[model samples]
Target: MSVIEEERVRGGVFKDINPEDEDQQPTVIESLCMNCYENGSTRLLFTKIPFFKEIIISSFTCPHCNWTNTEIQSAGRIQEQGVLYTLQVKTKEDMNREVVKSDSASTRIPQLDFEIPAFTQKGSLSTIEGLLDRAVAGLEQDQPIRKATDPAVAEKIEEFIERLKKLKKVEEEFTLIIDDPSGNSFIENPSAPQKDTALTVTHYKRTPEHNAVLGIETEEEEDDRKPVNDLDTMRNEVLVFNTNCPECNAPANTNMKLVQIPHFKEVIIMATNCDSCRHRTNEVKSGGATEELGTRITLHLTDPSDMSRDLLKSETCSVLIPELEFELGMAALGGKFTTLEGLLKDIKDLIVSKNPFMCGDSSTADRAGKLELFGQKIDKIIAGEMDVHVILDDPAGNSYLQNVYAPDPDPEMKIEKYTRTFEQNEDLGLNDMKTEGYAEK
Candidate 1:
């Protein structure tokens, strides 16, 4: 076995081993069976799932009582973000789709108002139908005792189990959701390289409660635990801190610095590098307070040389290109401080290469063609071959674009300030904010 495989064995789980090797069989040890209180043999097998991560499967069998139990656990590290998978089951074929539910994941059926809470059951690698079968088995397991004691409750549970069984028939449409704070669960996408229309996967940042449950500390918590001295002296220095790689979940270092733009306000730039995964990412954040009014900047691109202008797109900023009929929403790309050309390239990459459905077998010709054309137009804009107007709308009034004529107003660039609408303020979470008189209330 390789060193990596050996490490896995040391962690109480075996790595992938050749089945033909006589000495490389799965490790088996005597374990106490919970049901029979008898000695049982537990077999541990660690293997990789195709297109997924490593997992450990353990099976315990008590020969005396003929008791058996199987469970799966993810051998991979926790992910940087939580995942929510929504799969629509409309046909019998949908029941055959593969599903991997980690111990930290919760399963829900909206149509039936049923839920399996996290940590309530062991992790399993099964199909949709298999999940429903397990639910029915669990419900039926205690039905006999319940029927003898409480017939009323037993009748309701039996009726529910029948409804669950009916779901396997696909007589009605239903939605299955798997929400995993550890991001270890998965629902197979039947479309493969293409996007599955019936499946919607969303990744979100874990909340503080989730972090507490995971035993992960946030930067804020670290700061409170260890107070830094001389904040003024640290303003100009690059601050380095420990973090985990988002890609591989390995220990990494994040460097942050306060940078001041010559004509604009100060911003905090943070960059992280992972030695294990060789992954690097940098982002910018506005350091100043939100302005009283929103700012809209429009620049007409006429010369190719205009691509070199520096642009700071705040997290609250949206980008619009009227000629290309492209509108990017706020916080879509996070905060970025780069040249105009670089920003446009990033936008093209996001819409084309990074799009989940852009290059799959299920991608329609018309849809793909339009995205390709959109990419080409961006390239033209970057090369100065196309004349168009680019607008930066920031409701927080934090975005900035370089003015070629410093101190003097550029004729091609127009800047406008306007009061933000009530909806915009609400979206920014400013509607409920009480800056003063909070103690009085």
Candidate 2:
């Protein structure tokens, strides 16, 4: 670790302190859909705590589409009580770090949305709006603002975009502002690039609790966790149970409809059902992982040539990516030939390779031109639940669901059976024995 990192490892200003003395974290501006702009704020729970350098950033929700792209646009001085520090994060590779200042450096500060960082909460203040506005305005303008971009107006857009990417990454930095009985100031630009170095160290702070420290893993341990095929049998077997209808509580069944689906890799399951009351919601889940389908519709690539498939599998790394099986009927799968173009070249190649008639330039290119038709097919499958035409071998026809419906795995579960009984229950009759025949006599 570098000298500054060593200081941080020891704990800045917060050393020899109680866990209760944590400084208020900075806020991040989040949203629902990445593409949509917000007209008003929507209350939301933070999915996880965010950190900038060593400083932790707060979270907020957008009233719009619910995209969670939040960021720390300013140093935590307002929240830290008027003291500011320049805290440098690190290079993209996380090789070097520097703490240029610590609540004792600069006088000029970029304005922030929240006055008190501690009071930072939902509906209160936006942490990044002002800065975001400035950055976005600079982005919207055709001119460049800094020498970073020539001609000055459109120049900062790249920087803003880079910040968005960094926010997406776990690595972030906080500008620290602190306070003492006597008023003071400090500041530095941690965003500036760090010096190049060959030797590097990963940091792990020692906590009072013995469990805080993590040991370097042995090769054997790593080999055990190495990515392998995981099959969750319960994924498709569990009934699409719905408890939302006010009346009927039967299992809400979902038929796997494959409308012209050509590239089938991850089985896309859109979970839409209720088992208690009359409410239905849908979320996408892959066949390999747990069945907690999230709210994003996914497009899976079936190409064997690209590593993108594996990259997508380990969500630990981001490459964005979906599936379903049919038991009762033949499946037809396809999509607008055009959407395939945006996918990796391998997937596009798979499409053309399978449909030989679509081979070569203009002839195949003509096929690629029909995005509207492909979209309709996908809509029919996803929206209309239309089954796709697929080849299958079912001699016994056991999958026809006629032989065995499997009867909703453990259908008759009493929710309260596993819970602990209240102490009042056992003593109820004895203590209230004055009840039955004698009122208050």
Candidate 3:
């Protein structure tokens, strides 16, 4: 497209940008209808959005087959990282703030435990309230929530949506968080806080798995992709066969894939879903070496920057925060790749989410108090108010904890790696079997 033509497309969205281009027509591309085999039945209308740089809105429709679709595509280079926008909706005024949600953005209301995953809707320019309204509409048409077999579950979903509607009217207060791995989402900022609540935006690196789902591949990402011929890769990359669902004995398919972590190694993340019973299982396995002894690494976390250190905890890794007397094994935290702060937060959230008292049992007062105290310590550690030792022990030799200020070593940081005990090896199931399938001794 020519510069003037680009201006014409953008002018349609931003009137002030090109007032003299009133005679311009939308560019159309003719193609075969996707739904039907008919020729020259599909029409695509392209327009440029001014808010997002070089982003074009493509609307497609086929009159013959009545198939319609709308998507947002980027005409510019790929963004190096994802974007996250967070707004605290405390007043009706805040609800009026404009929002530009890309198709790849996911919405989350942590208070409600509700999430609208990416690819659920097309890109839109709307107010905060409008976004919530769309979310309510989506829930109404959601097959799983609307047609839930359990009456209580369906009713709960309905009630939660009603609360979301209240948010639009400023009758309720909740935090709205949007995560766009594609980095195409946006939220308006008025230079200062509208009321007592301020908007917070964060940009973070997206995992390779997310990039794969978004169809984004760069040279670095391509280099991290697993080769098809590797046996370990095939275990997670190939669909072995279809089998009956273990839950309902209905036919089901199991899908798995090898997701490589940038600046790190690959991992096999397997997932299985049963359509009949809706049974699902997801597991992450490391594609690293297996050694005779376990590995242990420790770091004294004191600065705020320390929280941003990269962490790769294999499924067999155990974590410890010495100051808080907190220790979680592989069974507790499982395999995860996150920042130090994120890992600490996850520990706190897990405690609260699983605590009987917090969940409404209310009988374990003593335990609840202890949990609250521990959680406070975690918060302090993350805020850099408290110094603590962070440790990772992995028997599988597949885990990693980057040296403080890694790729640049920090002199003040302490990181120690050591071997594991025979007892620890036994716990990792590394005992019993020999190379010849018999006792070595």
Candidate 4:
């Protein structure tokens, strides 16, 4: 048998076995060394991280030249959107946070104005300190040659390298940002299952230019090649399309349907399920154009039956609870069509369970107590044991709370319409949009 086959057989890395299985062992294979032009050994391991995605780690060692290289690659499909992670490094403990830097990801330190552009270095699974060490090593590697060629430039680079090294000590605060168009990179959240206050993770729709760089076709490009179909005519009919699962990145089908509420307008609901990971997600979106005036819906929860009221919160809607002094901004939970109780439960889960510093060793007794108390208040409100006002503010005026009295206005419910502010219009990208005279321009 060949060396690769023999190694696979000996390591028990079989095709029938799941590559992402935790029990799987690394497989060794012979390869050519680029530096020495000699045979080398490459060890490849496929593993899945807990609460994360699958990845492949490969390390190559040259026996003749004593050269070694390591790399990591995501074993999942590219995400539909790009991800930007902003981390606040304030303490030395922050240096221990794990980071998965993809080859397509760019790293930036805002304080030093230092950036490592995408494709400049191979992808690696390392901690923050490890990344800084690698950067220092890389800079030092070429310093001798630079010093002989240009002394002045070498001195500046040496100073910069020192600054990079000092970041590990975290003597001063710095912001580390990772922008990945492929969205496969990740920074470990020590507060798993909770929101990390110091770490902000934002997933944005990839721009056309970003998609082009990633070799992904834009929606406009795909529309040009395919015939356009009227979605309005297919209302009530479930449309199925193929997409990658957000959780596992496996191939899956998304089902979409347009449903018109009795008094409200049309809305589209989309659902996706992945068989490989058994992950499921559903989202709701407004099907109509932006309204001329923004809408604000307020409901007073006094009776237990108020929890049964159906509510539709658009992606552009912000939620506010006066009693709890809690305010959730738009896009926090995406669009959801659920009952009052369901919505409150989701909010409670988001604030209580997803809080990074609420339950872990990094948490303090005082802070954890406050969050725990806040969660109990939400439960009381949901149980109708407490009287509170729930407000829904939608800049696009697409959100709605079902009126118990259909023909007549409910006494406890209030609906107000007002002109959207310039900032709100700007947030919705309406300020830059020209409805007319665009062709002349």
Candidate 5:
């Protein structure tokens, strides 16, 4: 029998399994090391995870090359649909709550402009404060930040780190959002001081790419599966044939996949990395069909939770934030898939980038003063100290402002559908369709 089979049959590796759960035992699977291709050099340890049922913790290490990897996999036949866990962390006690985050989970703290992307680490079992600490450590260890020589940039990073530490200590309040497409992550509800009041858990459907990552294959689907980030998955099964880099005409690799917005329809996000020129570009395309009537959406950001709402803007959508004195025409921004606060920060960055002279360049003294004041107001709005209105106007009516629960409309939001003006039609190159009696010859 192979070593793995022996480990499965004679399970004595975890003799000290928690006394309360004596029946549980760890299984070891020995396989070839990925790094060195040495037989029996990789040992995968499988053990039952506490607090959650039908779940097993899997960790592997290669003695040959010191390679290590860990993952949380389900042992039972039943798998919950994708899930999102949102907790309003108010006090230091709230940060002490236990969290079981899967490797597939992506965490976001909107107010902090912080996100810990999926697959960045093997699953982590930590407290809310510990999670924030991980995010801080990641930022500090990031190559770009560590190697940056600009004093101003370094100062800003330090300030951001201090703010995050404050959040960890619960001196400031922010929403903690964890989205697990695999539905394997959880926040401890049993320890909540009040029944169902500390956190909100919502179940959602898994995307095709998500299911592929978890190896949840359906019998009806094709036997061959592509990687989750493959171009075929990004275009929703429509294969993109182009393989050459657009910038240098060199062979390049592309990864594209569809990601579902919480309160909106799915969007195809495509990214290409060029090895020749080291160029990278990302683009977003809507999954839904266009509408004849132009639509307008207005959202009131009166509460902190509103900042967490997802925003999807088509290329033809115009964005306006009156309080910040910001306006972007349809042609200004190509497209966007970001949260409300993220969108605002993007605009702030655009302003800074476009008007470099206004950032205390001394040559534009008056403009710098005005721009500085404008930037302060935007900062205030993002901090949730100032209430503002966000408006999205789409000539093609393809844009969307996320509702609280998708598919179920948000009655609190104001939406208006209007007839497209002549200019609007011209902008879309539809003026030829309006030439009264024109027909193909």
Candidate 6:
């Protein structure tokens, strides 16, 4: 058997059998070096994420032999050492009495390098087309849910459903954890190094076949979660963006996959997040145009196909928020999005407001009453002028993008447009232009 398989047999977390009882938690896996502390009982260790996800591996081994037996039981609580996580929030009404609280479990299921296939269940996500179909069907079918007319009645219904779902999900999650530490490689701190090199570094590699399978996944069907940063505040919202991992000074790339962001004045950008290292890398397009009209706002985004695919999905691409305009043939020249077909279709459904459209117009919610009426108008067009940005550079959405004529695709990008900013304080700035409005051709 291979070394990996051998370690799997001996020290693997997968082999851990949970004790049968209400009071017991899952066992922490460990292995002792025969040359070290082979005579002692293994101890149970627990970990928590704090102070930038540093690991504290502690165990009682024969100091002379340097052998470890007990599960490394260093009582690690993501150290609050120098962290000022808001002792309390001040309020007009003695708000200092109120404080925001966050609860993290000792077991957030350490990140693991599970094969992509592990998440490909009978449901969840399968193919790009299939997932989209499922989402569309989910929208079409009312999800077999019912509403209660009153608050009290609704509370009872929600409580019962929540209980059932919670129990079911927990049972499933327990069985799915093959290794206690899935992507957990080394505990961050300066723990004494092991005498033997048995403790392995686990990594996951996608086979050519798997890459092809993912390549076939509809790019639009991606649903990644993202955290918001409130630069205005200094609480837990102080998560670093485009920042490197505190442990290894290696570059940590981040991306945002927006879904259903209400408004740009103050908006929400949903995105897929990284499990290991808590990375936020995803695909992105860094350009667009901005046309401001008094109280009204306009946003245009360039297609992703015209940019480097590596930069688009890379964890390291810088964000450029004003290249809002797009011309055809950009993707053919290596742009942000892959192709026009899938990109446009996805954006259409989003701005059109159906089929799990993740990203939408920045001003979509500005004139709720007015835009509501205009949205009905876009539904009627098979190929009509869009009030929002619909950019792409690839032919993946559907091959039709292969023939669409997108001019100013790149060669025409004005250097001034690239540098223009409305205000230093603004989240983004673009060329201020004016369009009559969203009227058909």
Using all chains and alpha carbons, the TM-scores for the candidates as numbered come to: 0.60, 0.18, 0.41, 0.72, 0.42, 0.18
Tens digit per residue, CA lDDT, model 5, 1-441 = 655334433443322224366555456777776768875432333444433333456667777678876666543332346778889988787876778787788999999878888888767767788888877887687546554767677778878989999898788789999998876677754331113466766655577888787777755856486556554545456444456554333566777667777655678777778765576766578877667799999987777778788788887888877766566656544677778887777766655444423322112555456666767777788888897888899988888888885567676678899999997877666776554666767
Q: Which stretches in model 3 have alpha-carbon errors above 4 Å?
A: 1-19, 28-47, 59-73, 142-150, 192-197, 218-441
> What lDDT is reached at residue 247 by model 3?
35
List, residue by residue over 1-441, the lDDT tens digit for candidate 6. 654334322333222122343333443445454675455434442223222132223344544566553222212222211111111111121111111111220111122221222232221112222322332443334323434235665555455444334433332221111111122212111111111121121223333443343333323655476643643452223233553333222345444433221112221222334433353422333222222221111214244332221112111111121222222222111123333333333333333343111122212243343434434433322133333433222211111112113332333232121232354113221223334686887
Write candidate 1's Cα lDDT for 1-441 as tens digits: 665445653433333334554655566999999998989999987665532467778999999999999999876778767888899999998998878899988999998899999888999978899999998999999999999999999999998998998888998899999999998887866553234689877666789988888778776533445665765665779999998665455667999988889888889889999876477888889989999999999999999989999999987898989887677767457789999998998998877766534543335686678778888888898888999999999999999999999989999999999999997887677898889876855
Query: How much is 274 displaced in model 5, in angstroms?
Result: 5.0
Candidate 6 Cα RMSD after full superposition onto the native fold (Å): 24.2
Which lDDT values do the candidates have, in the order given?
0.82, 0.28, 0.67, 0.81, 0.68, 0.28
lDDT of each residue in 1-441, candidate 3, tens digit only: 666444443343322122256643446777776678664433333333333544555667777777876665544334556777788888787887767787788999888888988888887767788888888877777647456567777787788888887778877688899998877777765321111136665555688888888887644534575546767556455555576453333466776676776655777666678865477755567876576556777787668988898778777787877666566746545577678898888888766543323423232565566667778888899999997888887877777766644467666555444577787666555575465756677
Model 3 poorest 10 in a row by lDDT: 188-197
Which residue pairs of candidate 5 clash? Answer: 234-256, 234-257
Error (Å) of candidate 5 at residue 414 is 1.1
Model 2 score (lDDT) = 0.28
In angstroms, the error of model 5 at 211 is: 43
Whose lDDT is greatest here? 1
Clashing pairs for predicted structure model 1, backbone only: none
lDDT per residue (tens digit) for residues 305-378 in model 4: 99999999998898998767677767567899999998989888777775534543436786677778888888
